[model samples]
Target: MPRRGKVVLVQVAIVLSLLLVWESGVRAGLIDPFFFPAPSTLVARIGEWMSTADFWTDVGVTLLETILSFVAGIAIGTTLGIWLGLNPFAAEVVQPFIKMFNAIPRILLGPIFVIWFGLGLTSKVALGVTLVLFVAFFNTFQGVREVNPVVLANARLLRASKWSLLRHVYLPSATTWILSSLRVSVGMAVMGAVVAEYLGSSAGLGHLIAQAEGVLDAAGVFAGIIVLSAFVVALDAVVDRAEKRLLVWRPAPAHEV
Candidate 1:
């Protein structure tokens, strides 16, 4: 078999083995069903949830919030990163304030956002943007600062305009850094949305889990978790595809071969 196929097969085997063990333990009364639902029960619960329209709506809400946060964070972060990177004095002036904001635990801000924006989409998106923005900003700032001085000098000597330099020089140099941050930002975005929902929201996966937890329904909670895990995996796969397409010029590592 191809390496990828073999790897996937092994992974499947491992997961199945673990699930089998868990199910067996539950059946033998070695595990408490109330605390840890059987894998089968979780699967069934997920299927039942999927059959409902409300579940789909919750998914859509979470997805919209995640996408909004990811895009807005990247756009704003990259713009500021590039600006600060090019302007040393400005960066110095804002450095302390940026650090102060970044140092604040983002999770604690969820309630504040909910209070400001209410328990709605805006609060969730705001929370997610905070989680994602700093990651993009720091990576991009570093990338821009790390641009080769020689190349920059050469471009300037060639009479390149500022726009031309930014387009041809800074952005290309920072693309890898910016893209690398995206994978991390995806999870951050999801966490922000879910946490905000869990804290105070009427919909989304987080709300589902929160509702389940309130009722002490282990199966429902686990099922919600499984769904969220799958969602994150799907988003990560999309990011992987985008990364491969954008970095086609980059050489593949030996393992991928």
Candidate 2:
């Protein structure tokens, strides 16, 4: 077998063995299943959840917030990144203001969003936008700034119009960075939605977890967390696939499939 294939197989074996040990430990009471349920129990919860609409509703709500926030973040961030990056004066002028907002903890804005947007999905969407936009913005800005100066000079010398420069130079240069940012920001988007829900909400997995905590139902909390993790992984995978398609100019890494 090839070295990479062997290494991957070994890694999978190790993970499977660890899961077995964890399951055994829980069953033997060496670990408290109440606090940390076995993987099987969580899987069972997933099965039970699939049988009902309650879980689906919460999942849908969270997904809605995540999608809206992600779209808005990328749109706003890309526009700002491209604008600021192309104009040195603007970039320098706004650096401090951007950094100041970035430094603030996004979750703290949740209650305020709730106050302004209410306990509906809007609050969660706003919080998610706040979390995702900064990440996307920084990545895009860095990407644009890092574009080879020689390339920009060449494009300009060739009489490229403003629209042509953006399409041929700026957008292409920033594509990789923007995609990379999206990959990481997807998890943050989910976190923002959950945080907003936690602050005030009538629905969403975060709301369910909050309710479980009030009742001290560890299993339910764990179940909700597991559900959220699944959603993040699924969404991240989608982004990865889309990135590969959009950034076809990039060669696949030797380590990636």
Candidate 3:
């Protein structure tokens, strides 16, 4: 079997094993169903939720918020990162302020965002943007800063225009770093949206989970969590595919024959 297939098989096996163990424990009265629903029950609950239109609407809202956050964060972060990276003086001046903002726990900003933007998609997207922005900025800044001095000098010797240099030299150099940051930012974006929804929203998976928790419906909560997990996994997979396509120039690691 191919390595990827084998890896996937193992992952599936591991999950099944865990589910089997959990189900067995529940049946044996070794685990409390109220707190920890059986895997089967969780699956059934998820199916039931999926059959409803409300669930899909919640998913769509969450997905929209996440996508908006990811794109806005990347656009703003990349621009600022490139600017500050090229202008060392400006970077130095703003470094303290950036650090201070980054130090602020983003979760605390959720309620503030809700109040500022209202308890809707805007607030969720704002919170997610905050969560994702720093990650992209740091990675992109380092990427641009780490560009090869020799390559830059050669480009300068060729009388490359600023735009030409940015397009050909800087962006290409930073692509890898930016993409790496994107993978990490995916989870951050999702967390931001969900947390914001949980804090003050009428819809989204987070609201669903929050509702379930309020009613002490363990199965519903677990089912919501499972759905969210799958959602993240799907987004991560899309990122993975995009990364592969964009980084086709990247060399593959060597393998022993």
Candidate 4:
């Protein structure tokens, strides 16, 4: 088997071993089930959720919010990042404003968004966009600015048009940074959407978790968290696939024979 496949298998084995230990420890009363629910209990709760139509609805709502916010944030960030990266004057002019917004706690804006957009998908998506935007923006900006000066000079010497230079030079260079940052950006998008739901929302995993916490059901909370983690892992897998496809021109790392 490939080294990557072996690594994945080992990781799965480790998780399974830990889960077994957790379940055994809880059942044997070595650990408090109240504070740390057994893996079996959490799994059962997850199963119960899977059987409910409402659970699917909540999943859909959260997924929609995450996707919308992630897409919008990436679009806006890439555009502005590229523009500012190429124009030193514009970057300098907007630096302080960017820093100011970035420094503010995104969670604090959740209530404000709820007030502005109400307890709906729009508010959640808006909050997520805010969370994801700067991460993508900064990565793209840095990537573009860091492009090789010699390569650029050579491109210009070759009489490359502005559009051609951007397509063949600038975008390719920034793609690496943008793609790497998108993994974090996607997680932030999910966090933002879920947090907005926690504040005020009719549906979503965050709302479910909030409800669980309100009732002091540790199993329910753990189940909800596990479900949310699954979503994030799945989304991250998608991002990984996208990165591989889009960055096919990039050289693969050397592997031992």
Q: Mind giving the per-residue lDDT tens digits that candidate 1 earns over 1-257?
A: 89989999999999999999999999999999999999989888998999999999999999999999999999889999999999999999999999999999999999999999999899999999999999999988999999999999999999999999999999988889988878899999999999999999999999999999999998988998899999999999999999988899888887864
lDDT of every predicted structure (CA atoms) = 0.95, 0.89, 0.94, 0.94
Cα lDDT, model 2, residue 239: 92
lDDT of 2 at 64: 93
Per-residue lDDT over 1-257 for candidate 2, one digit per residue giving the tens place of the 0 to 100 score = 99889999999999899989989999998999878889898778778878989878988999999999888988888889988988899999999999999999989999999999999989999999988898888888888899899999999999999999889998989988998888778988899999899888999889988988899877778888888888888998899899879988877689864
Tell me which residue pairs clash in candidate 3.
Answer: none
How should the candidates be ordered by TM-score, best one leading?
A: 1, 3, 4, 2
Q: How close is candidate 3 to the true structure, as a TM-score?
A: 0.96
Give every collision pair in model 4. Answer: none
lDDT of 4 at 191: 98
Model 3: runs farther than 4 Å from truth? 1-6, 255-257
TM-scores for all candidates: the values are 0.97, 0.92, 0.96, 0.94
Which predicted model would earn the best TM-score? 1
> What are the runs in model 2 whose C-alpha is more than 4 Å off?
3-5, 252-257
Candidate 1 lands at a TM-score of: 0.97
How close to the true structure is residue 153 of candidate 1, measured as C-alpha lDDT?
Answer: 99
For each of the candidates, give the backbone clash count. 0, 0, 0, 0
